[model samples]
Target: MSAKTKNKHDQSESPRLGASAFSARSKRVTVNMGDGQKVKTLTPKQRGATTEQKSVAKDVKKVMAKCKEEHDMRLDLSRCEVTELPRYIKELSHLEEMYLYGNRLTTLPPEISSLLNLKILALSENMLSSLPDEAESLLCLKVLDLRHNRLKEVPFVVYQLRSLQTLFLRFNRVTSLTPEIKNLTQLTTLSMRENKFKELPEEIGYLRCLSVLDVAHNHLEHLPHSIGNCNQLVTLDVQHNELVDLPETIGCLTCLKRLGIRYNRIREIPAELEKCSDLEEFNIEQNKLKTLPEGLLKRFKNCSSLQLARNQFEEFPSGPPAQFGPLTSFSIEHNKVTIVPFGVFSEAKKLTKVHLKDNLISSLPLDFGSWVQITELNLASNQISKLPDDIKHLTKLEVLILSNNVIKLLPKSIGGLCNLIHLDLEGNRLESLPAEIGYLTSLTKLSVQSNRLTVLPRGIGHLVNLKHFSAGENNLTQLPEEMGTLESLEELYLNDNPNLQMLPFELALCRKLALMSIEGCPLGRLPPQVVDGGPSAIIMYLRTQGPYRAMSFS
Candidate 1:
């Protein structure tokens, strides 16, 4: 009873059908039973009906012939303009789940292999190009979607369906895969994403109980070193392929875990993935990796989220395994890391989110406390002007991005970071802000967007959980009328503070203010009492202003 009280009682017991009452209700109202008495009416059209409508049509044909003699038969002709299918549907013969998806069906009816207790067969978005070698006699088919069909070639009797296990042929004009699909061997999730597959059927390593293999946006360059013999593969999404190199027998699968080779032209990293020791989330973002195979982080010593951001790393890579155990989220953002090496993140120690944003670091190792379980520190576009006052020992910091740094000042020990929550210091040259940053108090998103702030720290109304306050491109000419006591501010961007003119009739006592940008502020207008106490205010009010602009919510 508590999941936010069952999602507010299922959003107050859901029932919201309005697109013109669901496009004029195409059948969905029913209730009628009798002889003992129970009835409600809507459907009534059995021409020449009498004698209690012929005994209610013989009790609905004896309950649909006892539900087609138990189970089976479940047909849904999607978007029904139904082109074909009624050869009395092969006399039902215990049909089982057949949905001809978004149809204009080009063909299909070798009497649909006489149903044979079919088990899920959806000819996806059809205009089907083939598939009726009696579809290999169903044999209790088990899931075959045939995605976006205009199929060039897929039915090698669908790998002789020995009880198929999920095979969705994505956007098909299928270019390959029928070496009799190495006889399916009980496939376990094989989606040929955006197909026209240019390679991939070295008998796809004979299935061997495959586990989720998505050939992402294909035209794959190379990949069938018998796909490293499938060893129960676990999620291998080949991103935007044209992969230049990979089949170092993909380090023999060793139960691979989430490996997305992003936008490849691969420049390195295949030291045969150091035998994928249970790899855990590794996305080689936009590849062309320059230098990183010095035993590739000591062979991902149980990696835990490593996205070598943007690539061609100029530094920061000394084979992560001086006992580097279970790393925790590390992104070497935009690279060419100028200098951050001094015990380079001292054995990671369960590091917590560190993305040295657009680096060229001028200074930081005043013992950056080997990242004391850091919490989201992105040193945004660096050339650091000053920070290491032992950075007040991070103390599980919560998002401190330091946007475009050249910091003019700040370290009032950053209000001893009482779990700071998002503080961006946007495009800095900060003129002010450390009156101990109004004592942090779990600050909630505060960005001094493009700074040179002329004023603001009148104890920022003691940050009672501030809620999004961005001094847009500053040179602020006014604002601390205790910022209308913030009362849970909800967005107040203060655009281009060109000597901000009005705005502090105690900010109309804040009443959860909802957005007020004050565009190019020298405010020749806008204080009809902060526009009538922000009736969900969104005033950008600009009347003729020049120069002095700034608004970067980065």
Candidate 2:
């Protein structure tokens, strides 16, 4: 065939999406080859991914071929676009592990049962809907992964594998677990996330060896009380479900350490949960919970993190006027919290992050900086009108967000935070900044847009590490000449300063500037060509022009 015709025929045989499933996993790098056609190449990382994929895919065929000459055999054929098992795999009677992930195979060949010694089988991410009866004959199999498949029911044959210890069936369409599951008493870990199940069989309690159970993102309306029989369970993740209440028996699992029940319709935290003395991480956020029982809060005081955002807790609920030991991160954003009582976290010395965005808080306590270990404090979209001067005490603060508030001034000590990296004070009524702001040498991004500022601190020049400066929609008519020393500034947003009439010539010294939004500024005397040239032209003018001439664009 001619070259054009040959290319056309080859394209017809290739998958419309890509060459194979292996190619789908690699990052694509397209290059212009001219004549409307482009060629794609793989990045170094993706090239390595292809090689690794092929190596694993070929292991299955190579091992089975050499099983007769070798004592031990194993195979992995994932991501090879396989639709069926190799006819010769039965020869590897000693195969211990078989991996066939990310393929088109819909059936587990009955012939595979011949490998009586198989200990693990991974058939995740495929089109398998049912298993053959022969699957039960593999009595020695200890681990099975059928995640992200088309299975619509629990494989009854899987229950026959009494030795199975770890079972993963996440992201399947299975609706419910049957009593047959109780037969697999050796299960230690079970994952069934993103499934259609509305209930788990009470027989699940029979798995006394179960240590972890993750059924998150399912339709489970309630958990069986028998689940408490799993005395060995340590971590239980059932978030994003319709569970309205706990089984009360949850407290019976005294060994549970991490319990995640967020994004549910639960109205109250069962008092029985206090019995789980081993709990460390409790994520009950985004639920319909309006009241936080004192018992639950007291028990969770030892929790390391609590995400209680987007809940119905009005009036700060009734929990803590006490310390939460080990509590490093606490978020209660988008609630009806109007006040953050003083010394709320006085005992929580390890606190690092606290997010209270979209609340009704109006003022901060003078000792707010007492949380010395705090690194991030987000109080955006609140009603605060002023800030306490002691805000400077938060020396370790790295991120401070106070946007959309009615504040008129910043504590002069605000610049003392040497570790501050990102500071946002947009939409406030600030008139000026303290010159002490220059003390923040670690600042990388600063936002002061929609404020009443007429001048910036001359000390702003000391921020040599700043990368972004948003000062748009302000009342500034002139900027400090020191702005030209910002060697690291890449974006300058000064779009709506309408009263500005002069453009500083020193701006051309900003070698790293890639974007400048200066449209709404009324620069009456500056050369029109300079403004029209965008950021690059402005730099070129500064490079060639000896001095910033009032009337010259050259």
Top model by lDDT, which number? 2
Clashing pairs in 1: 73-95, 297-320
| TM-score on alpha carbons, each prediction | 0.37, 0.86
Error of model 2, residue 356, in angstroms: 1.2
For model 2, give the 10-residue run with minimal summed lDDT.
13-22
lDDT of 2 by residue, 190-212 (tens): 88877899999999999999998
lDDT of 1: 0.73
lDDT of 1 by residue, 1-554 (tens): 25575335322322221121001112323455656666654542422344444544454344345546766366544544344554545666687776656556777788778888988887777788877788688888878887777888787778888788888877677888867788888878788867778898788898879887888878888888898888788889888888877878888888888888888788876777778878777888887887766766666667788888887788777754453557788888987788886766777788788888987887887568557788888989989998877777787899999899898998888788789888888998989887888888788889888889888878998887788988887888888777767778888888888887665555555556667676677654555654444424422221112121132112
